[model samples]
Target: MTRKAAGNAPGHAAGNEAGEETGEEPGEEPGAAHWLFGDQLGPHFIDPARGGPRRDAPLLMIEARSVLRRRRFHRAKAHLILSAMRHRAAELGDRVRYVKADTYRQGLREAVGDARVTVHHPTSHAALAFVRSLPSVRVLSARGFLVTHDAFGRWADGRGTKHLRQEDFYRWVRQTHDLLMEGDQPAGGRWNLDHDNRQPPPRGATDLGVPAPYRPRESEIDDEVRADLDRWSRDGDVEFVGEDGPRGFPATRREALAALHRFIEHRLPTFGAYEDAVLTGDATMSHSLLSSSLNLGLLDPAECAERAEAAWRSGDVPLNSAEGFVRQITGWREYVWHVYWHFGTRYRESNTLGHHEPLPDWFTDLSPDGTDANCLSHVLRQVRDTGWTHHIPRLMILGSLALQRGWEPGAVTDWFHRSFVDGYDWVMVPNVVGMSQYADGGRMTTKPYTSGGAYINRMSDFCGPCRYKPTVRVGEDACPFTAGYWNLLHHHRDRFEHNPRMTQAVRGLDRLTDLEALLEQERDRRD
Candidate 1:
C-alpha cells in the first residue's frame, strides 16, 4: 500500500538528510557510485530514482574492521551486522564493490577513488562528518523513518522551546499520514491507548503463550560472518562480549518482511497488554522483534505502521494494539530519531544531575554470574546470551539500575550502544541521556524511568524466584532496586523535591525510617 508522505502536511521543512547543515543537496548526480551504509540496505534507500533496480550505478560497501576493534561489542551484534552487510552485498552480486579495509576512507579510496559518490545520509554524527570530509561523496536524504529531518526541524522549531512534546508530534504525524484516522480525527476518538496497554503479566504464568517470534535461519553467509568474527578475535584484532549464537534477527530485506508479516499476523494483537510485561521464559512474549531489522533499514517504519493500522481496520487486531504499536514506530521511534539530530552532538554529553560513577566490571562485561537479584540476573543473562531483551527489561531493569546507581551518563550511553544488536549512536544517545538516565534533567521525559522492586514484581515473573524480598529495604535480604530507588530519591532530593512528577517519590523518602541505613547499604553495594 502506498502511504501518504509526511511532507504533504503544512509546516513541513525541506533540507538534506536529517537536516544537519551538511552543505549538500538531496538530489544526486546521474551515474555516481552509490555507497550503502550498513544500516541503509533497504529498497527505499536505493529506489529506482536513486539508480537502483535497473543497476544504473555501481554500489560501494565497506566492512571497516576499525568499527569492531574500537569497541568490545556483543559477539552476536557483530555477527548480525556483518551478516547483514554481506547478505546484501551477495544479493547484489557483481553490482556491489564490497571492500574490507582498516578504515572507511581506505575502503572508499579502494572502491571508487575520487569518483562522485551518491550515498544516503549516515545514521551517526561521526559517519556524517567523515562523509562530509570526503569531497567525492554527495549525501542524500535519510530513509527508513516516517518524518523528514526538515519536517521534524520545522515542528521542533515551531515549539519555541527546548522541550518538545512527543504526544503532540505523534498526533501531527497521525494526521499528516492519515494513519489509523477516521476523517479528521483518530479512529477510536482517542489519540492514545496507553491506559489499555499497561497490563501486568498474567497471574502465576511463567510465560505468555503467544506464538514465537520469527528467528532467521543461518545460511552460508552467516557461517562466513561467524568464522570471520572468530578469526578476528583469535588474531587479537577485536574483543567481544556475549555469546555468538545462531543469528536471531533478519539480515535481509526478504527476511525482514517475513518477520514483519509474522509479527502482524501472530503477535501484534497481544502486543499492547503485555508489551511492558516480562516472562522469564518468554523473552519475546507478544512483542515484535523487529527493532534490529528496522534499525538495519531492512523494514521501513511506514510499512510497519500501515500494516498494523490495516490489521485494526480489518478487525483482526484491537484498536489499542494497533494504535500502541503505531505510537512506538511513528511516535517514540521517530521522536527519538529527530531528537538525536535536533539536540545536536552536545546532547550526548548532557549530565545535568552530575552523575559521575563508573560502571562496574560485572555490569560492563554483561555477566550475571554473581548477581543474586533474579530480575537483574535474568535480564543480564538474556542480553549476554541473545544480545537483546524486551524494552521493559531494558528501561525498568537495566536502565533503571544505572539511574539508581548514578553511573556516568556518557559511559552508560556507550555501554548501551555497544551491548545491543539494534543499538546505534542515533538510537541510544537521546534515549539514554534523556529518557533512561534523565541526565538531561527533563528535556525529553518528565522524570527518570527507574523503579523499585514492586514494579519488577508486578510487571514480570523474574522477581518471584529471587532471593531478595521486594518489600524489604533493610537487612541482607533487602532488594537492591527497592532500597536503591529510595536512595536515588534521597540523593537527588534537592533537585527532584519541587518537580511535580517527582514530588510524591521525593516525599516518600521522608517516610522511610530506615533512610540512613538504606543509603549506607546502597553506598557500599557492589555488583
Candidate 2:
C-alpha cells in the first residue's frame, strides 16, 4: 500500500526490545515479531516504509476461542473472521506462527515467548488498553483509513464538539484528498448527490436486475472452520446465532480484490439511485458488498474511493454514482471511525433518551415469531439466514423498531455488534448509539432516524403483501411501525416540541384523535 493510502504518519514507535521505542523509522526494527490481528491482515500492516516488518518479519497470529464464547455471535460472522485469519496464516506459511488459545494472553504467551512484538493500533478500546498494558508489545498507528487519527483530532479540536457535522467533515476530506474534484471545485458542482440517490426501487421489480455480487467458493479451509465451529458447539466451548451457510463474503486478499473488481465493473453504475431502496426478493441490490472486506482490512478506504473517482473521470459511471459510492468510504465511514475515538469510551453509556427496556427473545434470536410486521420480520429473517442486510433495512427497519420500542441503547449496540458480519465495536457504537437509537441526543446526527410505515412503504417493496396496513394505526390490522412511530413521538413530545426539524412530526402527533386508543394498544403490544 502507498504511504498516502495508509494515511500513516512517521515516528509511531517501532520496537526492538519489549516496550522500548526504537530510534529507527516505523516497521524498520529487525527481529521484532509483527503480530497480525484478524482485522489487520492487509499488507500495509507490515509495510517496511510504515514500520519494519521488513520482507521477512516473523508474524504472530492468535485465534482466541473466547471471543466467540463471550458473546453469541452470528455463525457466519464467526466463520468469516476465523477464515480470514487462517487464510492469512496459510498465505504467510512458515513466516507466521499461528496459535489457538482460550485467550489472547494465553495465545501470546504460547506464540511469542519473550520476543518483542510490533502491532498496529487495535480497533477496540479494550484491545488497545490490553496491548498498552503488555510490556512485550509496541503499538503503531492505525491502518486502512483515509485520514490519520492525529489529523482527525486536529480537525475535531478546531470545531466545537457537539456541532461537528458530517457534511462539513466530508467536504474537508474531499478538499484535502482532491477526491471527485475538478481542480478547486467539487465535481458536478455539489458535494453530495444524496437527493438523486433516494429514489425507490424500480417498479414491480423483484431484484435490481444488476449482475449478482461475487461469492467466494469454499475450500478445505472453510470445511475445517465449519467442523471446528460445530465441534466447539458440541463440546459446549462456544455458541453461535444464525445459520452457518456457505461463506458469502471474501476472506482473503485475492478474493477481496475480485469482489471489488466485480462491483466496480457491474454494480457501481446503478448503485447510487437505489442505494437506499430495498426489494424484498433482492437483498444484494446494487450495493457493493465490500464492507466485510473493507472492515477486515483487506481493502484500504483510500484505494476504494480513488477507484470510484477514477470510474467517474473515465466516464464508465455517472458522477452521482461515483460520488455517492466515494462518500461512503471517504466521508461516512471515515467520520464514524474518528467519532468512535473522539467521543471517548463513555460514549457507549450515553443514554439521553433513558431507554432501559431489555430486548425480547424473538428480537434477540432473529425469529419471525416476534412480529407480524412484514418489514421487521423479513429483515430479521434475512439477518438470521445470511448475517447481513443492506443499511436501509438495518437503520430504517430493524433499528427503527428498536427505537420505537425503547430498547436500551447499549443492548441495541451489542446486538448489532454481535449480529452483523461487518460489525465491530468501533463501527456499531457510534452507529447504534448516535445514529440508530438517537440516544446521544444529537451528537452524531441531527435527530432520531425512526419512521412510520409510510417511509418504509415508499422506500421498499416489503409493504405490499404485509398483513398490516401502512396507513392504519388504530385496529388489529394497524401497522406496528405506523403506530410505533407516532407513539414514540408522543411519548417523547416534550423532547421534540421545540426542535425545528421535528415540528411537522410533533404537530402530526396532536392530530391523532385516536391517540389514547393507539397509546393503549401499543403499550399492550407484545408482537
Please give each candidate's TM-score. Answer: 0.96, 0.95
| Model 1 steric clash pairs | none
For 278-396, candidate 2 gives per-residue lDDT tens digits of 99989999999999998998987767887787888889999889988988988898889878888888999999988999999998998976888888888999999989998999999
**Candidate 1: tens digits of C-alpha lDDT, residues 1-527:** 44456663211222454554333433437668889999988887777543232257788899999999888999999999999999999998998999999999999998888988888778888898989888988766666777778677777776754459889999989988888888888998999999999999899887889889998899999988889988988999899999998899999999999999999999999998887888887889998989999999898887889899899988999999999899998899888988888888899999998999999999989989758888898989999999998788889989999998889999999999999999999999988999999998888988889888998888887776789999999889899999889988888899998888899889988788998888888777743
Candidate RMSDs in order: 2.4, 3.1
**Clash totals in order:** 0, 4
In model 2, the runs with Cα more than 4 Å from the true position are: 1-24
Residue 395 C-alpha lDDT in model 1: 94
